[model samples]
Target: MSATAEQPPFRPRTVLLIVGVAVIAFAGFLLLIAFAPPFQGGHDARGHALSTSGNGYAGLVELTDAIGSHSLIVRDTDLLGSSALLIVTPEYDSDGAQLARLLAARAGHPTLIVLPKWLTRPMPDNREWSLKVNTIWPEGAIAALDKIAPKLAVDQTPFRKTVIPPQPAAIPRLARAAIGGQREQQRLVGMGFTPMLLDRDGRVVMGKLIGRPVYVLADPDLLNNQGLADPWTARQGWQVIDDLSTTNEIAFDLTMNGFAKQADKSPLRLIFQPPFLPVTLCIVLAALLAGLHGAVRFGAPIAAGRAIAMGKRTLVDNAAMLFRAARREHRVGAAYAALTRDLTAQATHAPARLSGEALDHYLDRAGRNAGDPPYATLAWRAEAAEDRDQLLGAARALYRWRRNRTR
Candidate 1:
């Protein structure tokens, strides 16, 4: 066989298949990392979860627990049926319609709406507060309250600065509040609201609706992580909690803070969660097994023989067998006669003197007998032989004539 025909096996396709599978698996891994939740412990920002750091109110939430009061961070809106105080700390993006719906759900229940005042930044560590200043008007908070209570009026003007100490007040239905810190000077005009805690200038910092159980606190720091840090400010938080029924279960609304409970019914979620994890593991294992089976080689390959290696005799036998299999024995009759003629010329060296039909006729006359058919007739019969028996008899007669003429 030629060197080119005997080349070594080079299956680049197998290597390409392995690489393609690896790339797909890597892409799947990257997708999982991007979409899956991180493995860590910490509450989210935006005042949604019960966290003590930054803008979170985890201190007050935990303080309520310490004082033997049952408090929960309400993620699901369906749990708003309690008659207890529902504290809603609505951020800027809180939906007014949803807030209205929540208040409507707790129609008879007492709800405390703490207005967002300060625009504070989280520390570099993200566990402490930094740069805090009050806004001139909490328009979003006011708009939400306006949707629920149109009669309520909220002061848009910034509170006047007070150098004086906090004022002690004898407010009925509520415990004495310590007006410490800058809260003593925070001015808020509540036209229809009953003034509960007044600032140094007599502007209501805390108020209640005339007929409704809705209470409004102008400052969020009174009960947030920053407000709860001071002893005097902490008292105000407790008093506010006390005024709102301590016996009833208290639930802080986290829905406004972008913490909503979602019902996950997707197949991927099911596979990731509880009892189905094992099934998912099994499926993954099965896929890995299939990939390995497809990628790996089982054994060494067996070498095959060259295509054109047989001799002339073996080629003729194979050709005859093929003609017989195809029922085309007549097709080989002319080939057999030509082969006999060539053999006779090589043996006698008579092809130079006589050629074509003349040579054929000369040989036929020399080999003719009384009973046997003429050589020309036999040659013609071989050329036109149709059936297997006729073809075989004609081939024999031509061979016999060649042998006798050659001798």
Candidate 2:
């Protein structure tokens, strides 16, 4: 046998099935990636209302859900305008300019700004887990407080951690604030801050801005995931919100906490956004249907005809083309003369051994006997054509001789 490589080990059918399954899985993964941001359900590990981590306030949100209190996590900056009490947890690196604008807009509404304390990094092993290395610098926390209360500063060393009821009217609820047992002993300490709730040593734990309706919570541990571990602390946090909330929908702002989703004009991003999402789904479905149709299609392949055909007619046409290409037009007349000469000799029953001149003389006598032109003369005319007109004349004379002999 001739030396040749063997075919691949895998079957075509199995390969096709694997490819189809892989394509489907990839499409599912893309869909998951597109919808993950909006439908995350507040499972992040950052120190925000959307996080379920120790430093986060997601527990407070869960507490509201359990008590039948209406609350929502706000991802859009536009939602901050609602009259409800917005619990905003601003990160250390949050935009101060944007924070000022947001606080300014809520002049008529109730706003509570919670300052961040712990600085943590996400665990590489678990996405939902995080490790609080240490506390954020007092200056960094103060900068976040500076947006509305630039005069105030964040202080961890309070003379006391418990609230001191200085204002009889505000202390009724402030005194009952379950902000005790905080992980980081931090509070707002400065002059311009109107002390709504203060420590025994006069540190502002929860205070209001001078002229604005915005409130500041210096320590977030009371409402954070760690603080709300028990039922009592969770209820205290809920009570604080109930006392503050003016509107039916309580909103916790996530926009300032690095969860803001801006409009992306990239083709991949656009397809995952509104309006185009349906188009993307349709295109995927169409492709799947087309693939299915191709896979299940039935029929044996029809054999194709050969490029070069075989037959007397095909042979004649090819010879004609060759003669035309070679500029041997006179050769056509010579071939016709030889064919007619043989046919006439056979018709006259002439001997096969006869020479060319003898054959022509015998056919000429037979042609004269039949009341036709002499065979020699007809043959000479047929073999003498040099151009198109001459060739036509030769073909005509030869045809007549053959017809006369047949008759």
lDDT of each: 0.68, 0.74
Residues 1-407, model 2: lDDT tens digits? 43444666677798898997999899779767655565666555788887878888877777777777788877776677788889989888877877898887665799988888888887777767668888888888867666566788777753333444355554534343335465457877666867766544455677888877888878777678886886566666666678788767678888787665542234666897789879988997999888878867578867999998999999999988888888777757877888887876777678888868887776666666566677667667767877767887878888787767656
| lDDT, residue 93, model 1 | 59
Off by over 4 Å in 1: 1-45, 127-137, 150-153, 156-180, 183-194, 209-212, 246-248, 263-407
In model 1, how large is the Cα lDDT of residue 404? 80
Per-residue lDDT over 36-91 for candidate 1, one digit per residue giving the tens place of the 0 to 100 score: 53322225444533555545687878888888888877767788767778888876
Q: Report the lDDT of model 1 for residue 20.
A: 75
All candidates: TM-score: 0.53, 0.57
Each candidate's root-mean-square deviation in Å? 13.2, 11.6
